[model samples]
Target: MLKSILSFYYQMQVFMFNWIDVEKLVGLFSFEQYDPVVFGTSFFLFYFFAFLFVFRILAKTKDLKVWTIIFFSIFFYYKAAGIYFLLLVFSAIFNFYIGQWIFNSKNENFRRIIFFASIFVNLGVLVYFKYTNFLLEILTDLQVGQFNPLTIFLPIGISFYTFKAMSYVIEIYMEMLEPVKSLRNFSLFIFFFPNVLMGPIDRASEFLPQIEGDFSVSKEDIGRAVFLIIVGLIKKHVIADYIGLNFVDRVFEVPLRFTGTENLLAIYGYSIQIYCDFSGYTDMALGIALLLGFKMRKNFNFPFMANSVMNYWQRWHMSLSLWLLDYLFKPLQMGLRNMRGFGNAFAVLITFTTVGLWHGANWNFVIFGLIHSVFIIFSMLTKPLRTKFYDKVGLANSKVVNFFQIVFTFHLLMFSGVFFRAISFDSALEVFHQVFTFMKPEVFPQFLESNTFIIILIVLGYIGHFTPQKIVDKITSLITRMPVVMQALLIAVVIWIVIQVKSADIQPFIYFQF
Candidate 1:
């Protein structure tokens, strides 16, 4: 028993501490050469310790609490982003101070300069990291490889938090918010751990107030939080992880090896996998924040249920989408108000492409973004024709079009997601070819042979379907009615499950790469 206990602790330590200091490692090995496993492991351990150490120090100190949080946030952000975190801090501090500057500067021209500078500064960093590779390929194709080599790793969450900071700047420019008087709170807004990676891409107006306001947690709220975390765990580790291991990763790694149906299903699985993976991270983030006496914006809202591509974008990664709408789309939308037809189309393409390119410094991400832009643009263009077509068919209100619309949208997403998931343009094209080529009668039978996983997935779907809302409503309404002892026992069970089930296979959050 003693030997077993020691062995357990040893495994835990290995799991936590496996990967650390990537940019440092990359210095020795180069970026492409390091093991993904080692990098992920080091990150897990670094954040785990950082989260614990910061929690204890901040919990005990009032004077240094915010600063302590900010300090550790920077440290962990550094670990997560490598040296690129300097850019994150630079943006945050510059925006924090600039917002204050803008608020105080009553002069119209100076105010305008500050606002423009702030926007330019934020977007410059985003474009530099997010678009560098894209532009590199463009220049290479243009036979101009004279671009300076940038060996710098783009920091994690740069896209998300850059927007968060920009929103702060925008609000100041719009006279909607005063600059943060305290750098501590302002830093906290940008570096808050839960929303740090692959944000719901929270806005300053939404997140800042939560951190500043008083928060209370009930016993049932705790239970609800526990439930959300568990659900999130299953989504990420079980469903997403299994599919990733079994199909999506495999096919993408060697797309020509699989059939059309297999590739198609894998693509479908990946759409769910990514949604489950990403939104699962957000859920865990929210749940963790709840436990810490805070709230975050909901990142997803049953996006698959949307009837249109535009509606799908609105529902998915809502914080990021809304950020784009407020900062990117709306400005362009309003600016092009004078030039209606082509201008609107250009804005839609540019904004959605930017949204796609924001995902990575890759050509595939560009194509993915462009595909989505086309989806939205074509949807918008054909809206009248679609309405008229549905009416003429007398199926406007019929369940058939509704059903087909959902299916069509899901397929559109799956089709585009192939590009999103692929390692290269060729890989995505190969996956598409396999998806078309593998339509034999035997494929479906062979696929459904895994009754165990299918049943488990089905039950998981049912549980995931209703448990969250039911638990949240119940706990929110009747927390006081349940004794603390009961809540404690429930939470204990969840904690145990989290511990026991987290074996050697705890997959890192998928979006951590971006």
Candidate 2:
């Protein structure tokens, strides 16, 4: 009987060991094309919880904490971008050494050479990955060459991290910031996964100092982080995805099939969808960073309420806007200062055009950028006249006037967003054509009845957006004061709602393409 029992146990052990699929287990740590690990996914959540546990254990040892986070970040990137994570490491190393070289060199001529060369190398990689096919298409169109486009895998977040790396080098060259002495810390800045994919484009000057200190997280920070994460979940999975899948995508896909009013509403819907989607991602990123004991700058500020194009740019994607202003526009404007107003105008045109191009490699984006540039120039030129007119009409401080201005500015931006959202220039034009030629106001009742849920969500989104700052602050403060258990319950509820509302297939954030 003892011999029989021992034999049975050995057999069971063999069967149990066989059940473990070693290849599958290894695949979990590697990238899967169909199941790329990203924020808000089940795999990422599991990975994050595991990471948090490890992080807590190592928190007291500063070096261990930093290295642990770095390893986690590397694994995160590898799961997200596969072997391209190596590209990120190479870029980080290259830029780090370049910044140090620029800082240490005293020869002005050599510094300029290194500066331009580094810029070229950085931009060259970006151009090769992002615009090669674009340029090839252009050449084909011109009949200069009929070459086939090459297959190139764009490493996720190349645009964002490249900008961050360039800014680091630029700051050092400009003497505005010092080069990081330790490569490990520099790598952490670039590899920091929180805002890695989409970013407020955190600066080395602002981010590196925090790395020098010990890791810490306060109760208030935890509360705020929870609040922001919950809010982000609602915005993304609830509002943006719901409206987009049901309304905006249908209309934009085939604008001619919808009535003019429906087409117009789709445009408005897209504006809300994109804002909620992009800003939602930003909110989650900020919250995640906070949980890791770091603070990132804010990226948006109720952009829909802007009263002018200038105000809209200031409030919308404020990080990119500020980066452009500080690095591109200001530099160009200074270079052209000899020509005064004409130079300023030229700089604005060029800078905004670059802004549009930066969004994508397409003519529609170019048109979108041009449209903003023209409006911005007009806004600048008419500022004095508008000021005089408001003063003359005694409406400079009129609330009614301000409301109309806000509405008008929003419509202008919404119009530009058509190009931004549409699949092609032709598709964008079709949307406008439908609105202008086939607008059937009589179908409004039917449309409203059919899309009641989407419309209500849109309305609610805008209402939340336009809420006064004080009221929003109060809500955040209330959430922050909640007990830890309450906060956890709140997060759980929000997540449950997200799971219930989310479509069968997860909708990737719109800006991911950019």
Candidate 3:
């Protein structure tokens, strides 16, 4: 009996040990889980509020609050990217110290060297993880010796955080802002989980000041945060994911199988799909930041409302566009100011090219950026001509004229967005050819009938997007003004509705891949 009992105990211990697969646990905590923490996930929705509860308790003690928030942010990032959280901490430490050194160094020459070094280090890590494979492909195509691809997993949000680091160092080098005294504050700025993954690329000047203040939440702030969170959830799960799963993914995956009319409509669907998907992420980021009593810059502004390509860029991805304007376009344009029109055109072209390359390591993204560059440059060159024509036609201030321009500008973006969405140059070319040559008008009705649900969602998305700014604002204001409990109920309802509509598989935010 004693021997049998001992054998049973040994078997139980073996079973318990087998249950814990060390490799699997390591993978779980590593970059193996590529999907970042997003708004709609159960883990986030539940834990975020729990975090807020603890945060509220700590709010009275500013230092404790800051550290608590930092800890939570790190944990949040860990969930999203697993063990790659170490990269985040390393970046924070590296940048914080480098920024301090740059600011403290008395010699301008040394400061300049450190600035360049900072840029090199930050951008080098980014390019290695993001672009190595693309570069290898290019080399392979050129037959420039044998190149083996490296199995490097691109960490989520490296681009945003790298830019955050570079911006911090660049500003310090320029003497624009003082180096932060507290490492905690600087770390919070870089690794603040909400805006880190996808960003309005919060400027240190704008964000750092908030960190020093006492924490407080107003009714308006609560309302606005809840409103944005609900809107973001609907945009992601209800509209973006639904349209993607039903229409956009199917059409893009096998464009050749669909009719030309289907392909053309797919482009339109993608325009709305990407807008809803990306803007959804930004909305959630903004909302989450607001809850933390931090304000992020607006990242989107109803881009479809723009009347020209130049106007479109200003509205779409406003943070990145403005970043390019401030750091890149202004500097290059200033240097080439002597060249006049040629310089302006050159700067615009180069800026968009950088913007394209920043999106991903694809030639397709390059083409996508170039397409916008051409449109914007053409718009610039013809600005006077367009003005003259509008004045000649007595339509300079005409609502009708503005309407047509908005439509034209939107379609131009949609056309460029094909390259943005396509897997390769040849695929984009095939799409272009299909839309131009094989467009069959007769299939529209049947396609609509077959895809009535998706068509409704797509139409609704555009309607919401193009709705007058004032009406949307007023609606948002009213929604946000409800009592706190009512707001929570509203969010609960939205989440429940999302549950009903969401696809079986969660679609990661489109921008998370960037």
Candidate 4:
């Protein structure tokens, strides 16, 4: 029965991905004759059943069930992760063995050789895929030796999983945790389906240890998982997609066409759009992991509420941020302990710059990263003045200060985001110039009129900021208490609604290509 189930699962995955031949698929699907629902439904159903199969297999792992599931999980990832699947598998195997070798080997030279190779091999992959093109473009303008661009498809989660693999090695080497005994357990940690495509990327210490234990399901846990799934659904389809497709996307595509006020509103809309899109993806990932009886860590903590760049890092993309703090920030801080204040400042700047480059290979990402480094550096330089001002004003936590801090951070982050958003530096500057020139109070109303949903999205987006993670879980948990029949009925209605509003143009997850 499991074999048949697995076979059926694999077959559907192959069929849905008919995109391995993008040209052939496009040729077959003439617009006049195309049906978007057909493709979307195929994917939605494929994932749903795949989840069911994983649940069933995981429920009983007497033989090689875990490995079998891992096989298909990689197979499943291919639909989304694409060529990155090979890189993920290789990185996992590399780290898994290196971690064990380092832990078990007596030969100092061998361990160092393997360990150094693991770091560079993994980082080299990240650099090549994520930054190669960005570098080539810069070199081309400099009239350096002709920058020959070799077209490469970046593996989807290369940055995420590579960082994860690095964390594993560093943790193991540092004696923070022991290495895994089984390759299966290690691979599962690396390629766990829930966090593979988009992640609150888990560490081996936190995630792998749990895998070695028993498989027990809880009703309360089940309830929270269900609720998380629901919340994730609402965030993605209702909030992110609804606003992005209807409003934010339209304005950004043609910034010059809009008035100054419209440009401002459009930027505001994008700010909301990105947060919703990214946070919504993380929520869905977390909720799904919860359903499968795994607890992924929090990735976002209402980052906009944060007043300082340092504080913002604490709140946003927390998994990635925390990963950096542990692996990069702390190490640099500790390493530079002997240096004067200048050393500490330099280390912080360098670390944050690396943080930006980690996102992508673009110069804008570098600038985006550098902008934060500048904020951090400036704040550090005026540390005494900052503390004095706060003490004098009796307003460190005052409402007005909080509001302006938020406003200032929002614009600061927004401009950096614009740099990140534009295809090139010139485009970014054009948007900046137009942003200033297009000014008119009337533009706000016109922009709002054009994208009314976005204004509502912004309000709802902030409301989301206040909800505690615990409550989000508890709420999701409460929903799971409904009878299975009712639960199915609710899901059915949601599926129906999703189908009704579905467009023929199926936009892949924006981050998937990266």
Candidate 5:
């Protein structure tokens, strides 16, 4: 009996050792996968709470906190983009030294050269990863020696972090801000992980100080954080994913398969899907940053309520839009200021075209930008005539007239979204063709009946979007006062709803690609 027991124990030990390969175990914990840590995943949630315990302890120690965050952030980037974490390290060190040099330099010509050098390095890397294939395709189309596209691996968050790095140097060159003294502090600012992937695009002027300040989170802050997280989860999982899976994806995937009415509805559905998807990410990012005792700038402000293309840009993706405006549009406009409205028109066109290309390497994005620019320029040029027409019709003061204007603007933006959401330019044109040529009013009722749940959510999403800010603030204030147990229960309820409404496959956040 003793010899049999010894044999069984020996066999069990061998099985355990062989089953768990050490290398595989190490790989799982390392950057073997492209699974970057993102919010709203079960694995991320577990990792975050566990990390939070250690983070809180280190938070009181400034240097320790900064280093700890830097380490974890690097690790987080690795999990998200594998070895691209090294690219982040390279960016941090490179930018830190360059920014300091630019700041400390006294010679005007030298400063200018350094500034352009910074732009070249940052944009050069961006172009290599993001536009090599695009430029290759263009060469092929032009029959320029038939060069094949290279297999360029775009590191995740390259666009975002590169922008962050460029802004740091640019701001120093402009004398708007001083260079950060500590390399570690600068690294923390660029790679806070919360706003690193899809960004509110942290400004050095804004984010740098928070690293050195007191690390404390107020009760209201906790409430706001949880509220934002819940709102984001609902928007992403419940509204965006649900509608995309049920309606928009199908219609967009095969535009000709559906009737014109369905295509139009799909356009409307896509506008909501993108808003929920993007704004949901913003909510979670802001919430997570708040939990960490850092505040992120607002990225969305009820963009769908905008009454004009210009207003839409102002509200939607405010971070990127404003960045382009200050750094890109303003400079270009200044260069052509003598041309008056023509200059403004030129700058607006150029700026938004860049904005479109910033989204992806596609002609569809270019057309998307072009369409909005045309509408905006046309509106600006004809503003006086529009105002006179409104006065002549006695509709200048009419709320009903205002409502129609809002609807018109919303639909115009929705139309532009077709190109933005379509898989290709041909697909987008086909959708437009179907809208005008094959719209069947007779099938509308059946379609509406079949998509009742989706319609309800769409309506609710918009209503919530357009709801007064004060009302939202009031509701959030009340939530902040809830007992811990109640908040826990509310979270449990949210998770249950998410589980119930989630699509079969977890769709990635739309903006993560950018």
Candidate 6:
């Protein structure tokens, strides 16, 4: 018996040593993966826990907290973008100094020059990375030059970070925000990993102050963070991924293969899928930031509830919309003020066209932008007429009328989503073609039978979306009040559900491409 025990112990030691391959362990930290690290993954969760552990250890030291976060954040970006992470570092350094220069300049003319130069450099980088192939393609089609498309890796989150950087410089130039004194703090603002990929587009004025202040996390913050993260996971993995994989993708890929009813339902599915996909990411981003004791502005606000195209824009992607309004639309409107109503209309067109082009280099995105622009311009022009008609019909304050208005606005946006979600302009047209022409009502029963679960998810998704703010707040409060053990159990249960429901491959967030 003693001899057997000794042999077993020796064997176990050998096995343990063999299992621990130092090279493989180190490779895990290297930037050699084909896919970027994203939220809602086992890998991200593991690293995040490790990050929090280190964060808590250094909680009392402000310098350590800031530097540790910056280090982890840089590592996060390196994993996400590989060598391209250097671009983020460059952007932070470039923008910090530009902001300082803008703020320190005493001469108005020199300040304006510096500001424009900064804008040009910032936009120049964005356009080169995002639009180089696009411009080349356009030139190829136009026969201006026979050019092969150049290979360009769009650094993930370039659009988002570029906007953030630009906002910092612009705000400083306008004297709306003072330049941040510390380069490390400004770097943290840019490199803050949670919102770095897809953002609520944190402003320096708002986020820099938090960095300078003391770090503290309340019980309520913890509860809210857990709630948001869980809800976001459900939205992405349970609803968005499941529905998109099972239904919407099939129909959109080849609308001619399905009936009009299927096509119509697919359109509806896409609308919800995108909302859940995007807002889910925002939720997780916010939750993660909150856990770090930073708060980002809200990004989505139950956009489907909006009763007009304008209101829809206000509710959907609130951060980007506000950015456009403040930076693009307002300036354009000011420049075109002398044109009166035409100016407003033109500004709306120009601003939203930029919105479309900002989304992608494709004509489909342009159409998506144009559709909204036309409706917004129409809404602006017809506001008085609509109000008069509503007042005359005695339906201005009717809940029923408002409900229909919401429905109408939802469908209008859904219509534009065809262009937004399709592979190309022709594919978008094909979707409409099939929807209008392929009236196969005979397949309805079979479709309903086959897609029962998807239909149920869709219904539940909308129901959750339409849940009143009061109810959402109450649920949040209840979660906040729960015992620590209960919260842990809740999180464990939700994560289990996510693991069960998620597809074989994790669905990258929709806005990651943007």
Candidate 1's displacement at residue 99, Å, is 0.4
When 3 and 4 are scored with TM-score, the better candidate is: 3
Give the number of the best model, judged by lDDT: 6
Model 1: number of backbone collisions: 6
lDDT of 1 by residue, 306-351 (tens): 7778888888888888888887888898899888867788888999
Evaluation by TM-score, superior candidate among 3 and 6: 6
Off by over 4 Å in 5: 1-28, 32-34, 58-60, 388-398
In candidate 5, position 197 carries an lDDT of 88
Which ten contiguous residues of candidate 3 have the minimum total lDDT?
Answer: 27-36
Task: Report the backbone clash tally of model 6.
Answer: 0
Candidate 2 has a TM-score of 0.96
Q: RMSD of candidate 3 to the true fold?
A: 3.5
lDDT for each candidate structure: 0.72, 0.88, 0.86, 0.72, 0.87, 0.90
Where's the lowest-lDDT run of ten residues in candidate 1? 31-40
Off by over 4 Å in 2: 1-24
Q: Encode model 5's per-residue lDDT on 1-514: one tens digit a residue.
A: 9999999999998898799987866765687554666688776777787778778864567677777778778888888888778888988899999999998899999999999988998899889889999899998999887988798777887888888788888889889999989998898988888888889887888888888787679889988888898999899888998899999999999999999999998898899889999999899889988988899888998897787889888899998898889889999999999998999999999998999989988788889889988998999999999899999988887898777878899989988899999999899989998999999989988988898999998887787688899988887888799987887788778978988888676678888888
Ranking by TM-score: 2, 6, 5, 3, 4, 1
The per-residue C-alpha lDDT of model 2 at residue 372 equals: 94
Total backbone collisions, model 2: 0
- What tens-digit string does per-residue lDDT give for candidate 6 at 127-213? 999999888988999999899988898898998999988899989987899999999999999999998999988888888999987
lDDT of 3 at 418: 88
The alpha-carbon deviation from the true structure for residue 501 of candidate 4, after best TM-score superposition, in angstroms, is 4.2
Judge candidate 3 at residue 345 and give its lDDT. 92
Q: What are the C-alpha RMSDs, in order, of all predicted structures?
A: 7.0, 1.9, 3.5, 6.5, 2.6, 3.0
Clashing pairs in 4: 223-477, 224-477, 227-476, 260-438, 260-439
Better of 2 and 4 by lDDT: 2
